[model samples]
Target: MPGETAPVGLTLALGRLRALGAKGLRVALPIAGHPLGLSGPPEFNARALDAGEAVIVTGVALGLVPEVFQAGPEGDVHSEVVWRSVPVREAPPADVPSLGEAERELAEALREATEVLSRLNVAGAGPAAQAALEAYRARAGRGREVLAPGYPPRALRVLELAQRVGALIEIAHGAGAGAGEHGAAVSASEIAARAEALRPVERTARRAQVAAYNAYVEELERGGS
Candidate 1:
C-alpha cells in the first residue's frame, strides 16, 4: 500500500505466523517508492536481508516507472522503475509447548510447594517431615514425580529448610497471568527470613540427632547393640 504503517499489521501478521507454527520469519519492506534506490549509491538496488524474524524496510524510489528493458537486464525479474515491496516470509514451526500449559504447570507447582510447607507445621511433624522428605526423595529419584522435572538437590534442601521454619513464610501466587514486561515478581525474602529463623533450631536439632547416632555407633562398635 502507499502510506501503510507496519506496527499493527506486523504484530497481527506475526500472530498469524505463530499460529502457523513458525518459529522464525523475516519481512522486507520496500524503501519508500523504490525497491533499491538510496542515499548510499550501492549497486544491486537492495541490501542482503538479516537473520531472525525481524521486519526491514528499504527506501528506494521508483519515481516514474523505469523502462521494461531495464527491469530484467541480466535475468532480473522486475524492471527497475522505482520502489518494490517484498512479501513477508512465513513463520517457522512452533516447537515450544503451549504457554497455557506452562501457566497451569507453574500454578500447580506453587500449590504443591505450599502444601508441603503446610504439612511441616504440625506439632509432631519434625520426625514425620524428615521421613516424608526421605520418601519424597526416593520417589522423586524413581522418576519425574512432581516438584519439577529434573528436580535439583538444592530445591529439596530448600524444602527441608522450609520444614524447619514451620510453614515457609513466603509462597504466594501473584495476581493475574505471570507473564509480560510488567509482570510481578514474587518475593522469597519472607520465606528466606522464616527459614533463617528456623535454620538455627533445625541445625541444632539435627546436630543432636547426629551426635546421638554417633554415640550409639561407638557403643555398637564396643559390643553394645
Candidate 2:
C-alpha cells in the first residue's frame, strides 16, 4: 500500500510523500530535553524526540520517522525499513544563528574543546574515540551536501563544523576507564569540568545543524526560494 503509513517500504513511503502536496522537506534531529530541529505539534515532537531523527513535510504539517528491522525465518534474511507518519502542526522554525555567526561561534567552541581535551589528555585518550572522529570526518568529506540544492555554501560549512563538534562530544563521552572523567576513575570535579566544556559545544552543534537543515525552508519563507 503506497498510501499506508506504517509498515511501508522506502519506495512506497516516498510515493506516498509525493502524493502529498508537500512544498518542501526539513530534517529534525532531536534529543531528550532539547527538541533541536523540530517545529511541531506535540504528537510529532514526541515521536521525533523518541526516534532522534525525522523528516517533516513542509506544507503538509506531517512527519515521518523510520523504524528498521530484520526479517526472515531466523529474523536475519532481510532488512526492512518502515516510515511511520505522525501528524504535525504548523510552528515557527527554531531561531538559529546566521551562517557567519555560526562559523565564528563554532570556531571558538572548537578552540575551547581542543583546550579542554588537551588539558585533560582526552584527544586520543581512547582509540575508539579517535576512530569515531576520523570516521565522521571522512564521511562528511565524502558526502559533501549538507542539504539539498538551493542552500547557500555557508550552510554546508556550518553543518560540517557542527558534525566535528558532535565528534568532539563523542570523543569526550567515549573514553575508557583509564581516561579522565570516565568510568569509576573519574573525579567529581573532573566530570563536572568536562560537562561544562562540552555541553555548550553540543548545543552549538545542534543549533548549527538546525540552521543548515532549515536554510532552504527559510529561504522559501523569505521568498528567496
Candidate 3:
C-alpha cells in the first residue's frame, strides 16, 4: 500500500492516553513553515505542525518517552514558545496480544535472517561487512531476550519491529560478502555489489515489519471502534 496515510500510530497513542485517563494534555510543536527557521505559507505550516504534533502526542501517550517538548517561536513570530506534557501515565489493558508471543515471533524472524547471513559467510566479505554482521548478531541476541509485562501490546509490537529494523539494516550491510575456504578477505567493490544483489531480501524484510506494525495498528483501531 504505497502512499497510504492512515495515522494508526497516532491514533493508538491518543487511545492509550484516553484509556489511561489523561486529561487536557498540551503538546507543543514547531509552527509549520518555520521548522528550524524554514518558512512556508501559514496554512500549510499550520497543517504541517498539526501532523507533527500528532506524532509527538502519540509517542508520549505510548510511553515511548517521558514527554515531548518544543522550543521555538510562538505563532511563527514570537521568539520564545514552549509545549510540554506531564509524564506518561500507566497504560490500561486493551487485551491485545501477549508480549511473550510478540517476542517469540520477532526472535524467529531474526533467527531466519541470521541463518541466511551465516550461510552466506559474510564474515569473509570485508571488515565493514564483517563488523556489520557481528553487530547484527549482538543485536539479535539482545532482541531475543525475555520480555517483561505491563506495557501496552501495540507499544510492545512497535518496539519489536524497531529492533527487527535494526537487525535488517545490519543484514543489508553484510549482504554480499563471504570469505573463501582459505579465509581470504573480500574486496570493497565486491561487498558493495553483493549488498546490491541482496537488496531484495532487505526490502522484503522491511515490508514485512511495516506490514506487521500496520496490522497491529489496524487491530487496535478495530478494537476501539
Candidate 4:
C-alpha cells in the first residue's frame, strides 16, 4: 500500500508516546487509501475530535500532516489531519449539511416553509426552503439549483416535495459501520456509498411529491375560483 505502513509503524509511535508519559492520549489510524491519492487520516482525526477526545496527529512526510486546525472550544486543542489534498480547481458547493438525519430535518423545514408560504409570507421561508431543497438534491444527486434564486415561493413548494421523499430515502439507507461511533463523518467511500444507496428512495419520493403537490395546488386554486 502506498500509504499504509505496517501496524508496527504506528504501534511504535504509540509506544513512543507511552514511553514519553503521554496519558489519556487518543491515537487515530488511517485505515485505507484511495487511488485518487486521498487517505483516511483526516476523517479519522475528525472522528476523534468530534468525540471530544484529545489527539496529537503524527505521520507527516508520508502524505499525512496535522497542520490544518478545526478549532475547538476554550482550552481544547483542535486540528485537522491531512493525508492528502488536491488544489481546488473549481469552487465547491456553498454548503453540504449531513444527510444522515437530513430527511427528518427536510420534512420539518418543508412543512414550516409551506405554512409560511401558504400565508403569503416568504421572508423566513427562504432559509427553510433552502435547507430542505439542499437535503433533497443531495440524496437525489441533483445539483443545488433546487434552492436557487428567482423562485422563492416555488422553491418552497419544491422544498415541501423534497422533504417528504428525501427524508424517507435517507432513513431507508442504513447507517454505515462506524458511522455512529465516528460522529457520522466516515471515509469518503463510505459517505459516497451511503448517498448512492439513498438515490432510489429519493427519486421515487421526488416524483410522488411533485405530482401530489401539483394536484393539491390545482384543486386549491379551483376552490378559490
Using lDDT as the measure, the top candidate is 2
* Tens-digit per-residue lDDT, 169-212, candidate 4: 43323212133421132356654654554544444344333333
lDDT of 2 by residue, 1-225 (tens): 234533755676666677776777777778887787677777878888877888878777688887777878875589876667888777764446667778888898888777777777676566666776677778877876656777888888888888888777767766433444352215778767777778888888887787787777767867944
- What number of clashing residue pairs does each candidate have, in the order they appear? 20, 0, 2, 1
1-225 in candidate 3: lDDT tens per residue?
012343235566456566655332322223333231112334433443554531122223322212244555776653422222223323421222333454555555566555555555654545656665567678666656323353355545645664564565464454434533111225666556546544544444433333333344344545676
- Give the true-structure RMSD of model 3: 13.1
Instruction: Identify the superior model by lDDT, candidate 1 or candidate 4.
Output: 4
TM-score sort, best first? 2, 3, 4, 1
Q: In model 3, which regions exceed 4 Å deviation?
A: 1-121, 126-131, 143-192
Q: Give the clashing residue pairs of candidate 4, or none.
A: 103-167
TM-score of 1: 0.19
lDDT of each: 0.32, 0.73, 0.42, 0.37
Better of 2 and 3 by lDDT: 2
Error of 3 at 180 (Å): 20
Looking at model 3, which ten-residue stretch has the lowest summed lDDT?
54-63
How do all the candidates rank in terms of lDDT, highest first? 2, 3, 4, 1
* Candidate 1 lDDT, 1-225, residue by residue in tens: 234354235456445445544432212212323221122213222332111121222122211111223544567666432222333222321221222333333344445445544544422334433444455467546754223333344333433433323222222111122232111122465435435544434333222222222232223334632
